[model samples]
Target chain A: MVDLNVFTTTTIYASVLALLSLGITLIYMTTRVFNFAHPRLSLVAAYAAATFMAIYARSAHLKPNLEPAETSIGYVTVPFPASFYLVGVVAATVFGVVAALVEYYAILKPLLRRGADYLKLMIATLAYDFILMAVLFLYNTHRAVKSALSNPLRLTPTSLSMTAYDVSIVTEGGTFIAGMFIFSAALAVALAAALYLLLYRTTLGVKMRASIENPPLAEVLGINVERIYAIAWILSGATAGLAGYIMLFATSAGSLKPISATSPADEIVVSAFAGSIVGGVNSIFGSIAGGLLIGYAETYVTQLLQAITGYPEMFQYARVVSMAIVALTLLFAPSGLAGLLRSPRARRLLSRIPVPGRARGGGR
Target chain B: MEEPIIVVDKVNAGYEKLQTLFDVSLEIPRGKITVIVGPNGAGKSTLLKTLFGLTKVYSGRITFEGRDITRLPPHERAKLGMAFIFQLNNVFAELTVKENLRLAGHDLPASVLEERIREVFETFPRLRERLDQKAGTMSGGERQMLAMAIGMIRKPKVFLIDEPTAGLAPKLAREVLENVRKLNEQGYTIVLVEQNVKAGLEIGDKGVLVVSGRIAFDGPAAELLARKDLAKMYLGIS
Candidate 1:
């Protein structure tokens, strides 16, 4: 029988991963640049939320009383104002937008105007990622020192837990359902729906799609391609911010430690990129599928292998699954799942492959 | 002579650091088909692109309807009632025919946009039937019709078309030229660059032969076609 707790935690993780992958795919479609700083953009939001929660906790006189709870989860602290979590969410989203716009205007736009090729533009994002990491490091250290010296409530500036702030429901069957799971799932669905409506139903969305398909042709048709691209960046940043904020709950549910300042850039970036690539970097919805596949596989596959092999240490190798999947995707379907489904040539190739029951048609 | 709708005054333009059109001057009269033909790499398409502000103008002035537009960007030029149809990749291949028309009239009011789409349907009824079909799946001739229909949706004052029949079969090429003539008869000024020199000049009101980015001859279409020496030496026509 599958463990309910593990399933809930895995679903939460998959929802957040889907949002992150969608942001990456949207940015790629608009700018045609692989933004290495994108994961750091999410980290910016995570740090922003953590900092906001700390400030709110201090102001509300909530003493940092860390104790072990009855549950399997490790640490528990005094809950702050429930409304204060909203403040954290807002702060995360705003900071994400500001950071992304900074990358676009300060770095990407200037390089593009100077006629930098894709390689230089991509390298510029890498440099920007390093810069963000340094900034985040210094800020987290300063906050840690300041909180240690002056504040009675001692929260780690680099890491955060959302358990205290999260509301949970105990099922009649004695199962615990984390609020994060519901919130993340609902938000991901809402975001996907909103994006679909915006892209298909609105004039600005049509203009954006047109610009993405052919910028020069769009320009001749009087569409401001630059403005559409800026809007895309705004959407990318917003989604990244939401993903970062919700990720804290997944961390709390699974490992009992909140995501650290370095976690997104160091660990989650690989899975996010793998999701986008395996889903088809050119498709928005495909990236979501990619994210879910990677997220579930990373958790459940590790659990299954560990159980079968009687080795508890197999969880550490979970990321290898993502790497393997990415390699297979690139080898067989470089354009990703969307191409296999949509492109006639790819479909033809698929039909040619000999299946046990399916009759093959003659080659054109 | 009728008043020229577009006047290129000694325009020297090309892509960055490459000067293709050198001190070239021309005038396109209103309500007439002006055909621009030349040998390979003679900057025929470049001249069309220059007229639509797509190329870098080192030093020159292009006046459209008595307004200077040499410094305007392509979008701004488009807003000034000029439509440029490229030789290839002119249509958004991923978009449906209706979506392409909607994007062409992006800034129009909803009612006006619908009205314009209806007008476009009147011109090319095939687009109405294939309203939901992806443009990339359409045949070459149908794609050209859709491109023209997209241009027509905006009701632009002038059409700068570059090799509309570039890759089509000969029969379809003739049909496309016939459609161009029909568009001209409907009172839209057209400046067309064509590789099929004979067919292009046959329907052209004015003929311009550009050789190595220079205007070798500019006159009535019949007069230019009657010149056997220029036709044999430049156009490889008997």
Candidate 2:
């Protein structure tokens, strides 16, 4: 008997992680920058959503329902209007895009023009992440001060989770799934499909792919490679922002606990990095698969180890599974799952391993 | 006879602070192939890149059709009736052949691009057969043909081709050179850099020899080929 709750939770986490991984992979492909600040983009989105929801609830004169309803499995004490969440999503996405553009135009673009190498650019992104962290901390402190001075519903921007507002749907089998799970899963599929269409069906997509493969040639062919890169950054930021919003509700931690400005992002960066690397950093679709695999493995492997060891404390080391997966992937499949599938030699090697349903001489 | 299609007036250009071409000057005549031959590291490709606005020009003027274009970027030069084909990694290797052709004429009107692609197919029928194949999967000779075909899709007035036969077999090299001649015959001015000095000069209308970043000889191709002294001393054409 599989636990429906665990399945839903894992699905939500996988979807959000997939979005984050895609953002990282897209930015890397276009600019060749590791973008250490990418995880922070989601943090910005989460804060934006928190602030929007708080402001909207106050304006609408809705009482803050900080406690979960009896029927709900997760959070969402108040019956806030759907428009509140919509505004939050839009705000998060816009802020995400703005932060990404600032990183590119203000930092990466100037350094690139000055002929900075990959190492310098990566370090620059790391510096930008620290700067962003400080900015977010200041913003959080400001919000805290304002919330203390304000009237009724105590909503601090530093501590926010959409799960407090989420509704749960009970199934016929006496189980339930959070609405956030459905929303995150649906959004992931929609975004992936949209990206595929944009990259393969449209002329702009062809130009972008061309620029990614060969910028000099694309430039000589009269394509504005810089403009293409800017567009990619915008897309990457949007994905990160939306994923952050989704993550706010998807997380299963204490509803009332205050999360630090950086803690949520800090917790997920390794998993996101693992996903991108396991997918073969160069392949966007591969990153999505990698993210899902890592997300599931981190959860299920931890659960299995705890069950086997008969120790509940083993769950505290769940990230160790992700770390181990990253290490093993780097050692055995450095090119990633996509690269292995693409290479004839790798495919031949994989065929000889006699996996179930494996075809012989399938190398193309 | 007519004003040369492109005039490099004592141009000093190179990568950032490297200065590969030193006060070199040359003119590319209209409707003919001008071959640039030089020893290794003699800046033959740099000269071509300079003409295409790929390098930093320290000083001097480059006039294309009487318009000074010393500071224009590569894409702007491409828009102003110039096509540059690189020696390596010239095509979008991951893109399909059809996608490559479409991207080459990216700014063209749909009907015009379709017509141009058709004409390109007529010139290189092999590309038509491999329309769905990735450019990287093609043979070296086929890739060269596709590079030339991509240039043709633009219908530019001048083509700047760098070592189109750099790593090809002897037979394929000759075939590639023959295609360059055919492109010239179609009234497109060509500036080519070649390692095969004798074969390059054999197909060229004018030969410009460079040694240590300076032009050692610039004259009719047959005249340069006939000079046994200059050939043996610089080009190892004894």
Report how far off residue A156 is in candidate 2 (Å).
Answer: 2.4
Q: How is the predicted docking of candidate 2 categorized under the CAPRI scheme?
A: medium
Cα RMSD to the true fold for all candidates: 5.5, 4.3
Each candidate's DockQ: 0.52, 0.53
lDDT string, candidate 1, A153-180, tens digits: 3446666555555656555456777778
Worst 10 residues of 2 chain A by lDDT: A251-260
Write one digit per residue (lDDT tens) for candidate 2, span B80-187: 999999999988899889899999999999999999999999888888888878899999999999999999999999999999999899999999999999999899
Candidate that would win on TM-score? 2
Question: Residue A6 of candidate 2: its Cα lDDT?
Answer: 83
Q: How far in Å is the alpha carbon of B12 misplaced in model 1? A: 3.3
Interface root mean square deviation for model 1, in Å? 6.1
lDDT of 2 by residue, A1-364 (tens): 5577887888888887788888999999999988889988988877777777777777777664445455434333445657877877998899899999999999999998778999999999999889988988898788464583243335555665556567566554556668887888898888878989999889999999999999999988888788999999999999999987887766573111234578677778888888898889999888888888888887789889998999988867877898898898899989887887888997668667866633532223
Report the Cα lDDT for residue B6, model 2: 97
Local accuracy of candidate 1 as per-residue lDDT tens digits, B43-110: 99999999988889999899999999999888998999999998999999999887899889998889
Error of 1 at B58 (Å): 3.2
